[model samples]
Target: MAQAPPMNVLEISAHFRVEHDKNRRQFSIRLNGSHDKAVLLYDYVGKKTVDLQHTEVPEAYRGQEIAKHLAKAAMDFVVEEDLKAHLTCWYIQKFVKENPHPHYLERILH
Candidate 1:
């Protein structure tokens, strides 16, 4: 049997799709080559002020900047819905701290 070739960043990034499972209160991305691979995971607080509770990227997906995409998606959703946000997730907190976009910063719960 032949092994599949490893995906390059552009190839992998092109296939990336983030989905919000509102029922589960999570935002996630499925990896392209592995069924068991969860590229990113983010859970949130669903109250008046949505608190981003946790974020995880499987070890295999780390260093690929996948978490950044997840953070942006979650923050964009919060902004679009006109909801406040609390960055309780350390990864998200760090991402926001580093990127500091005005739109995301404005909605943050200080």
Candidate 2:
């Protein structure tokens, strides 16, 4: 059965469709009728952990808080899956610090 998205995921979807591709280890948003994308990249560590490594938004798509949405989607996935996270990406680190989610923040691995 296809499961429902988490509440935060649903909320973000309303603004932009943040798509997660597990095999690719990235979460991305591509605007409608546009080919560019805003993406957050991560790497799996062991079995239940991830290292958020980088985020990039096309120049044409910058200054719209798209990175923030990507951060939220990726972090929400980490929390929903009960996985530990290592915030190697500066933006993700900044995002977490700015918007506190106790349960999600607790999963950060140092």
Candidate 3:
């Protein structure tokens, strides 16, 4: 049997999709091409202020900018909802600091 070639970042990312379960208070993305693969998890606290609590990406997906995508989605949700943000998650705090988007930064809870 001929072996299949590995997928590039764009191809891999294209196959994945993020789901926001408001009931569960989490954002997740399943790994592509594997039914049993671990998902990237982003847990948050939502109210007047949405506290980004934790982020866990599968080891295999690290360095692929998956976490960045997850953070962006969560931040975008906060912005769209007109709520403040509390960065309790270290990764999220760092992401906001490094990326420095004015829209996101303006909503951060001091």
Candidate closest to the true structure, highest lDDT = 2
Tens digit per residue, CA lDDT, model 2, 1-110: 98655332234756687888776788888776488888899998869989999999988778889999999888888998999999999999999999888988799999
What's the ranking of the predictions by lDDT, best on top?
A: 2, 1, 3
Q: What does candidate 3's lDDT look like per residue over 3-106, in tens digits? A: 54432222225655666766566766767656533332434455477777888887877887777777777788788889898887788888898889999999
Would you list the rank order by TM-score, best first? 2, 1, 3
Error of 1 at 4 (Å): 32
Q: Write the per-residue lDDT of candidate 1 for residues 37-108, one digit (tens) a residue.
A: 443343455656787877788887788887888787888878888989888788888988898999989999
- TM-score, cand. 1 vs. native: 0.77
lDDT of every model, 2 decimals: 0.72, 0.85, 0.70
- Screening candidate 1 with a backbone cut-off below 3 angstroms (N, C-alpha, C), the clashing residue pairs are none
Residue 48 displacement (Å), model 3: 1.6
TM-scores of the candidates are 0.77, 0.86, 0.75
For residue 57, give model 3's deviation from the true position in Å: 0.7
